[model samples]
Target: MRQMGRTNRARYLATFLLGYALSGLLTGTWTSVETLMDYFKYKPRILCVESKTKPYFAICPFHKEEDLLVSGSIRDTGIWDSDLTHLLKVALSLYKEAMLVDLGAFIGYFTLYAGALHHDVLAVEPSNSSFKRLRQGLLLNDFSATIKILNKAVSNKRSYVHMGKNQKLNLGKMHVNSEKDTDDRENALKNEMIETVTMNDLLEYIHVKQAIIKIDIEGYECKAMEMSTAFFKEVFVPFIFMEWLIIRTNMNSNETACTWTDAKRLVDYLTGLGYTPFAYHPVFTLLDPSAVLDWEIDNIFWQHKNAKSLLPYINLLRKVGPKYFDKMDQNQV
Candidate 1:
């Protein structure tokens, strides 16, 4: 009976291993192999990596929270958001004097990359923990002089808002509540009062006339943009990469942000400003302005339609295209 039981257990183990191997190959997710590769990418004690040779970027290692975002790809996967990063390079090429603005900058992945590229940068982070980490990353990369960080929220008004942190994983992706709305008693104690600034104020603070901006400010992007009509009309923002995956209509249950009407308001506003739309996911795709916009896409790219200098580069992007294949580079760190 004991011999029979041992044989059954062995058979079960063999079946499980075989199933895993087949599934991994079929789904293109070989977790064990990827784990081994990421393991060698960074030194465990230091929590930082290099791009080629010189020290590139450092991350906040507390619960490895910073790694949960774009920095994770930069450190573990050997590649970051090459699409947006590449697009940034292209825009910077067009406007040589423009600055890179990373709004809601989580530990400064894009900001660090831009700073390393030797461009002036402004990284705005509202969360305290993330702000501290972003500053540390700048100091580590030796970009303190060129890259300035603002510990404030980008909002419709220049006032204080209550922000609650995601203690579970991301300390940066906080839940912003208005001073008028105090219904969330659960996270009330955890919520901190953070000062807010408008998009115009941000650009003015950095003395940036022409700018390339990345907006990842939770779901307040629409509100901020709506409030910054004057800034958008006056500033030379040739390019903007904005987070489009909305907070949904029912903010409490995690559904759409307010029927598609609210999102349309945002699109209409941008279109009125002479900006063309593009989606960042499934590659850098050019979106038809007349078609129905999908708000579920993670990120959206907007380029000035009237900029004469932007015409050629955008046409070339449509012709050649950018690839985001996360290839394992041996010296990626």
Candidate 2:
């Protein structure tokens, strides 16, 4: 009996040790596989395996499939900016055959699409790296002549300004407070001395009577709006889609932290501009519009007051499109 007991104990110990070793090996293998998949998922690939069928598919440098051009190019490395493609679609719907200005044109994804639709677009991007990608995309998509690609940042004043990190890629921060002063960095790499043009300047240069403007400048949206105030008064940009978010980031010398601007200021500005704010997702806002909703980070379609005539199109958009409605119900309330 004693001999049998000893043998069983030895077998049990060996089995336990074997199981532990197997678990470690399996875990390591799993981790390696996941890492490999992730690396390939974001690596830039040829979006076009076949030319004719893949016109719309460009390998996303960020997403690995040229499915939707997220940032300035496929070379960008960051989380996807969900609003870029959707906003482009919305703008295209409104200005199918009109002239448009794409302020902060990162990789020219929107510019290329707008130009493809045969709409004259003034694609303005401030980042040299991002602009290079934009230029490549325009050429690859054959939109060089269609789009007037400008490598400059638009601001209230025409002078040199600093370009921030990630190169026009959406840092996911909402509303740059034009009213509030941010920390000035003399050593930031993304800084540039591009020509700052106002809406008036754009009109003077482009010689257009009306336009559809899409503004997506990291957090300097309010500044852009302030600069465009004159143009808004003079010209007839009936449709304007601006990025309004509540961004949390380190500011004031990367030491201070704050929740940038709440959506109210931009909404108020739009309201003041005689544009009615349309919430992107109504279902989320239907629950409580006053409460901060996160279903749609980007709120769009602040049309001029007289542009209410376009409600049918708006309604159609909400019905058949990817936008969230009831978003602006709180503004009404």
Whose lDDT is greatest here? 1
Locate the minimum summed-lDDT window of 10 residues in model 1: 324-333
What's the TM-score of every candidate structure?
0.69, 0.58
* Leading candidate by TM-score: 1
Clashes of 1: 7
Kindly list the per-residue Cα lDDT of model 1 for residues 193-223, writing each as its tens digit. Answer: 6777888786565675777888888777776
What is candidate 2's lDDT per residue for 1-333, written digit by digit as tens?
011134433443344344434545765523234432332332223121111111232211322232234532333422233344444444555545556788877655556656655667887777665575565455344454557777776666655554433423343222223333333434332443345555556766465666788777765555566656667766677777665442212222232222224333545666677766555543312212233334254445566766424455445554665334213121221
In model 2, what is the error at residue 221, expressed in angstroms? 0.7
**Clashes (N, CA, C under 3 Å) per candidate:** 7, 13
TM-score between candidate 1 and the true structure? 0.69
Poorest lDDT segment (10 consecutive residues) of candidate 2: 46-55
